[model samples]
Target: MSKMSASNLKLLQPSPPQDGLACRATDGALSIKTVGKIYDPEGVHVEALRDCSLEIAAGEFVAIVGPSGCGKSTLLNIIAGFDNLTSGEILLDGCPLATTNTSPSPGPERVVVFQQGALFPWKTVIENVTYGPVVQGVMSRAEAIQRAREMLSRVGLKDIESSYPGQLSSGMQRRVEIIRALINNPKVLLLDEPFRAMDTVTKSASHQYLLELYSATGKTIFFITHDLEEAIFLADKVMVMTTRPGYIKKTLAVKLPRPRQYAMLAAPEFIAMKADLVGAVHEEAVKAFEAGEREMA
Candidate 1:
């Protein structure tokens, strides 16, 4: 919540990012090694994850997609420290957060944005955004108000400080939630389908808003989604997980140029990437569906 001081903040790109891509520094990295999780509810021993290894570069955006019950949410929860991994190790920026022998408690370095709106309806926009730091005493109310205003201006919501969450458009409300998270200066933003509930038009607007925010701040993002297009569109890399007892089935590097644009969606590169993802995920989805059917029978 303290000021970054000019030296602590470095602009990785001289010019603001165009084409909707973030200009990021290479720190705040994440490493997951042979990660595994098993739920022992009544000793049912559900193996939710296994042998899952991932390397996420600091300031890079990565998305993970898989069918239902494939441990997508489990992995995100573990990264956010809401759940303990039964086995494996996780390190953030080379600091161990979780290992095979111990559980990691939640900390400020990671923050999550869920699909539902989290802004306090009773609080004005400015109040909601400033509550975290100001309440924690990390910053004086005056300083937090100043910082929140600057963040609002960056996201083009400077005029809405007096407005309540009930009045802002859904897209604008989501942006505020993001600003609230960014104000805390977390190392990674964990998004659990934050835009899944929006309609097409609203989602499109929010997508651009988020793309520009990511470019400007260079915050590393770990997104979990069922939407294949959303994953490929926003991530530097896309990871596809297998059926239950999930593991990384494939990882694709998006070679599409940064400063991303909707037109790119129709390009051969985008189409090819989507096709590849569809194939990989569909295979696993079929397996998951069959397993479910057998259980029902």
Candidate 2:
């Protein structure tokens, strides 16, 4: 079989992300109220999220948990300025979020580490980590290099600065992505299942590391995940979402003592809390499934 010519293949390729880098700015608290999203013009409008209202404090770690297709990712995207709300509003501190087509000024305070790591394969680890600071014009070449190295060390990847993404494991790749996100000292870290591909052991370790990062930097985190245990372990406040056309089913404050350990997972209090969350989420999941069935019918 003959390969397509470069000229012919160019047109078939997808356009790359505009390669904009977010800078660090004072990230105000995130507030969403009665926010709804509907994605249909002529068909039955499918609501990905409905009337979801929540407030994440400037330095709190909040975990969003729900079943598949529950709009967890959708909600995160809305806050990230990647999606639009059909009704209601999202505010940062008190200012409405910037969602116009123009790339907002790079605010080093809010950074998102997508689930896929989304690293550039051609770039070495140092380059990948340095991309954010470099693009934001925050540091000189030498300064950015030093900052990148420091971030890599913080993530336990100091010796692997020259490694390529393809050479690292899924967990390692995630660390690189995280370090890149944090190099700018973002105030609010939006993580969309950053550990979905890791092994259980790796996940646990990464979880602890993340908590340490949270405590050390006081960086507010809005994390989305389907794993109940993971949410239970990490969040200071766990927000449960209903299934499709998701809504906030419940928001439970995890009063579990911090500096947590594995023993907490096996305790009755922990188990009870987990059960309560599961029950709350289960109600929404079932309702969502039935709604889908009715729509199909």
| Highest-scoring model, lDDT | 1
Off by over 4 Å in 2: 1-28, 41-44, 98-108
TM-score of each: 0.89, 0.85
Candidate with best TM-score: 1
Candidates in order have lDDT scores of: 0.84, 0.77
User: Model 1 off-target regions past 4 Å?
Assistant: 1-24
What does candidate 1's lDDT look like per residue over 89-208, in tens digits? 899888888886666677656878877878999999999989888876777899889888887866678899999999998888898998888887778989988998899988878878
Model 2 TM-score is 0.85
Q: What digit string (tens of lDDT, one per residue) describes model 2 on residues 188-288?
A: 78999988878898898888777756665566799999888999899999999988777887899998998778889999988999999989988877887
